[model samples]
Target chain A: MNEIKIFSPATVANVSCGFDVMGFCLDSVGDEMVIRKTEKKGIHITHIEGFNLPYETDKNVSGVSALAMYNDLDLDFGFEIEIYKKIKPGSGIGSSAASAVGSVFGMNELLGRPYSKRQLTEFAIKGEALASKCEHADNLAPAMFGGFALVKSVSPLEILEIPSPKELYATIIHPQIEIKTSESRALLPKEVKLEDAITQWANFGSLIHGLHTNNYEIIGKSLKDVIVEPHRSKLIPYFDAVTKAAINAGALGSGISGSGPSIFSLSQGEETAINVKEAIEKTYSKAGIEYDMHVSKINTKGIKILN
Target chain B: MNEIKIFSPATVANVSCGFDVMGFCLDSVGDEMVIRKTEKKGIHITHIEGFNLPYETDKNVSGVSALAMYNDLDLDFGFEIEIYKKIKPGSGIGSSAASAVGSVFGMNELLGRPYSKRQLTEFAIKGEALASKCEHADNLAPAMFGGFALVKSVSPLEILEIPSPKELYATIIHPQIEIKTSESRALLPKEVKLEDAITQWANFGSLIHGLHTNNYEIIGKSLKDVIVEPHRSKLIPYFDAVTKAAINAGALGSGISGSGPSIFSLSQGEETAINVKEAIEKTYSKAGIEYDMHVSKINTKGIKILN
Candidate 1:
């Protein structure tokens, strides 16, 4: 297969109680890419569309990730990439992750699937690091492996795939505001009270159990971020109002997605997800903040091939 | 039932990574009690053997817990309890928990079990607080609910019963020394680093997932304690040596049972448990510390009835 077309998924990381270590894939929003084999010996970003992104191989996330994967392989030929970017950069819903995952996934497929999905995640995070300035697998793992992902240990690069409930869906509302990763990170305290840490871990353990058992109430109750959200939410306009509206409209829970500017809620069904979306829209409309929204099923099969 | 004879198991709390929130019941080590319905109007401690403990109802853990349960119920008749304490206090394993759980469990049986295992945990913590000086459900939950238990929250009392792998076993070594709960608690920092908290939650989530799926290797990997052990281990004699011995002998993982002095290790099967026990015995002997040790399977039934 000289040429391949694929759809790469967007992801929500730091999922409420699971800060810096957990994430889930989304189905409705993503980017499409076409990767073609070339005689040249290095990665080439031949075309880009729908987004203002650099065409240089080292500067782009997809190209960087593809290069990371390619450099390890003793291949005779190189690859040219065409990105049809749809997910916006800095949306806090893993926009860069989509592109990073897409290129590696496509290249791996073209090479007749030499590396495992987990290996692909390792490669993707190299590209993810270029954007976040930190090596984190929370977004990359979910985008590559699909469903819910738990980054057990980053040093060892262990990613545990958690099964998503069949009816689970996500509603994302990206308020068009830029919150620099460094700024959001700086707002957090260097040290947290041990009492709060215990509460956070308890909720995190319960959330994992709830996901395993398909208990919606437990999931809802456990979606609390006592550590990061309080400080970071101040950066976004009407954060609390949007979350309260989503919860009142039947979302299982709501929290600032990733580092925020975008908010996310998980609901048990598509109908409730749509309700959550409409509620967020109403709240954002009242707040007079420009926003983009999408309702998506928890994508069980992450990056998909497109003919 | 006019009179009930029961076996309430000892429990190992803070199973490595699950500090302050997780625990598992033990099979071979526990306390026995005989609870009898009496014409008396209040709790009476009639006979005591094997251990010198307070006989007054309010001062005694079992009496306190029984009273806590009794006060909630408008019982026309009071109860008498006989103590056959085998598990020693200040052993780090849940010795007081056995007594507390036994009284309430026997009373619940006599009263036709109005309270669930979860509710029993609530009553048991009332007794546990007398010893620990704080409301912690880690020990009580496992002693009441059986298997492995996750104390999701203290307020509003949520206990999530985790599945124990069939082949799992515990090896416990109790060095005859006193480490006051207050002193042990004082050893902990009021605030912990954010990076350490992330590692802790990641391990916690992985540990819960491992328990659910019966993945022993994953369970072994996830049983890491980065938060509390560093300070607390100083109080225990041969802590590092014993853990090293246990690990070298094929135990999955080891840590301080609750606070200090007593150490526990988990292994995959009976043979490994015995090996771990022998290894710990060797280490403690070399250190010349007077110690008591037991090897037992993970008790799936928390408390049991004896005719």
Candidate 2:
């Protein structure tokens, strides 16, 4: 295939108790990338759409990811790529990951699918690093592999796909604001109390169990962040009011997605998801913040080919 | 019924990556308590068996647990309790938990089963506090609720029972040595690197997934403790060699059990558990340390009543 079109879904990282370790894919909101083989020896960005991202090969996330894949494969051919960013950048719902993951995913298809999903994720990390200054796979892994992915170790690049409940629905609200990923990350505490850390671990363990066993009650009870969110949520407007509204409206759990400006709530069914969206909308609307809302079931399939 | 007999199984706390928050029950080792109603006005310990534990109501774990339950229920009737302690004290295999749990369990039965398993765990925590000077339920929860239990919070005493695979077996080795729990706990660093903590959470998340899904490979890979084990293992003789031997003999995971002079390994079936026991025996025998070994399937039933 000389040309390939790929769509990489948005993702929610941290997932409350699982900071820097867990994430899950979304079905509806995503970024699209088109890659076509070229006679030139290096990757190039020929066109851009939606957000104004860098076009330079070394600077753009897509270009960086494509170049990494190309170097790993030792491919002789070059590729021209175009990115249509639908998941707005810096929304904290894994916007950059869609670009980074889509680039490697599409490039792999253009290069005859030489790399596995795990290997593609590894290449995509370089792109994520370009954007965030540090390589993290919590977003990239789920965006590449689909569903819930756990980054067990970054050094050895161990990523495990956690089995998610089928009825899980996500409701995300992206407020028209930007929270720079680096600055948002800097807000987290350097050292966490050992007591709080143990509680977080227990909740994380319970969350995983609930996801695997389809126990929504356990999931709801365990969906608490005693560490990161307590610090980072301050950056988002009306975070507490919005989350309380979502929970009162029957969301199983709610929290700032990734690093905020986007907040999400999870529920069991589509109707409840829609209700959660409405609840979040009421809060954001009252706060006078323009927001985009999406309600859909979890994306079990991550990146997919687009005709 | 005027008299009731109860057996509370031993438990292994920490479980590698989940320090102070996770534990599982053992099938073979435990404590037995027999409770009988009396016309007397107060709770009493009539007979003590095995180890020479304190017989005072406030000092003995069994006596403390029974008194806690009696006070909670506001019962006017008196009770006489007999303790038969098979699990060694300070063995780090939750010996005190077995006594505390068995006491509350037998008392609950004798008092007509007024308390839920969760409530029983709460009362048992009081008993554990009498022994350890802190109210912790990692061991008590599993000993009360059975299988694997995660103590998500101690404030309101929230415990979640985690599903375990049927073939999971535990192999425990108690070397003839004493490592005070307080001293071992003090050896842990007060502050952990955020990076290592994140990795630990990932492993913990993966371990939960592995347990629920019966995925042995994921369980084996995730059964790593980077924080507590590295510092505390120095207190146990032949810790490294025994763990290496167990892993080489096909034990899926091995680590120090709680604050230990005891170590445990987990495997798929009874045969593998026996092999792990043999592997541990070889190492300890070579080191000239007398050790007691027990291999059993994961205990699904925490406390059982006997005639």
Candidate 3:
């Protein structure tokens, strides 16, 4: 296939207790991209739509990520990419990750599947670093491998794909404000109390167990972030009210999607997710903040071919 | 129904990455007790054997735990417990937990099992606190519930029972030295680096995923303790050497069991577990330390009726 069209999905990182390590893919919210083979032996971002982003190859996340993969391969041909961006940058739902993951995924496909998903994630991380200014796979893994992803370590790049329950759905509310990943990350403390760290890890382990067993109650109980949320939540307006409202509306749990501004709730059913979305809409609307909302079933497949 | 004889299993708590939250029951290493229904109104410690311990109800862990459950219920009959202590105290192998769980399990059995394993664990925690000087259910949860157990929190008393892979076996070496749980616990830093804590929780979540999926390689990779082991291992002689030896001998992983002095290794099969046992025995023999060792399958059932 000389030309291909793909849909790269958005992702939610730092799922409650799994700060810096966990993330999950979204089904409906994403960006559409088109890639075509070219005789010229280099990468190019020919066109872009719906969001102001650089067209320069080095400056664009898709260009940077695709170049990272393209440079290593001794291919006879190059590729041109066009992104129809939908996810807003710095909305905390892995906007950069969608762009970053899209190019590499498209290139690997056009190159006759030369790289593994893990290898594609490595290329995506370079692009992601352009936005976060740090290397983390929390978003990249789920965006590549789909479903729930737990990054055990970054150096060796170990990512475990956790099973998503069939009935699980995600409700996301993006309050139309930018919270840069680097700036939000800087708000965290360098040291945490050993007691609080223990609590955090316990919750993380329990949440993983709950996912494996399909126990919604256990999953709900374990969705607590004792370490990072206390400091970061202060930056997001009405964070507590939205969380309380989502939980009261029967979400399994609610927390910051990535860093801030974008809040997410996980529910056992689509109806409950929609209810959580309405509750968040009411809460955010009352707060007088312009916001975008989405309700999606957990995406089991990451990047999909639109063609 | 009147009298019950029980064999309560030993447990290894703080399984590597799951420090302060995870534990697993052992099949061959445990203690036996005979609990009899008495006409008198309180817990009684009638006979003692195998080890020096208190006869007073309040001082003995078994009697203390039994009393905690007994007092909570308005029952006509009291319990008479005869001690058959086989596990050594301060050996870091949940010795107190075995005795503590034994009486409560037997009483609940005789009392028609009114208390759940979770409730029995609550009673057991009171007895465990008498030894550790802290209310933690890492050991008690496994000794009561059997298999791998993760105590998510002690305050609300949440315990999750994790599935044990069928081929898994444990090799434990008790290097005849005393390291009190309270003393070893004090060795930990009041604060830990945020990066290390993140690594710890990542490993913990991955370990739980490995257990649920029965992926032994992931289990081996995840069996790491970054926060607690570095300081605690210093308290145990030849800890580094034992761990190195166990891994070299095909053990999945090794670490300080519970607190210190006693070291444990997990292996995929009984043959590998026995091989790990030999490696540890040989290493300790050269180090000129007197020690006792046992090889046990993962005890899926916590307590047994020996009749």
Off by over 4 Å in 1: none
TM-score of 3: 0.99
Q: Candidates 2 and 3: which is better by TM-score?
A: 3
lDDT of 2 at B149: 90
Candidate 3 stretches greater than 4 Å from native: none
Top model number, DockQ: 3
DockQ of every candidate: 0.89, 0.73, 0.96
lDDT of 3 by residue, B43-111 (tens): 999998899999999999998899899989998878899989888888888999999999999998998
How well docked is model 3, in DockQ terms?
Answer: 0.96
Q: Lowest summed lDDT over 10 consecutive residues: which window, candidate 1 chain B?
A: B280-289
TM-score of 2: 0.94
CAPRI grade of model 3: high
Q: Write the per-residue lDDT of candidate 2 for residues A43-109, one digit (tens) a residue.
A: 9998898988888999998889888888876656788998888988888889888888888888778
Off by over 4 Å in 2: A38-42, A74-78, A110-112, B74-77, B286-288
User: In model 3, which residue pairs have backbone atoms overlapping below 3 Å?
Assistant: none
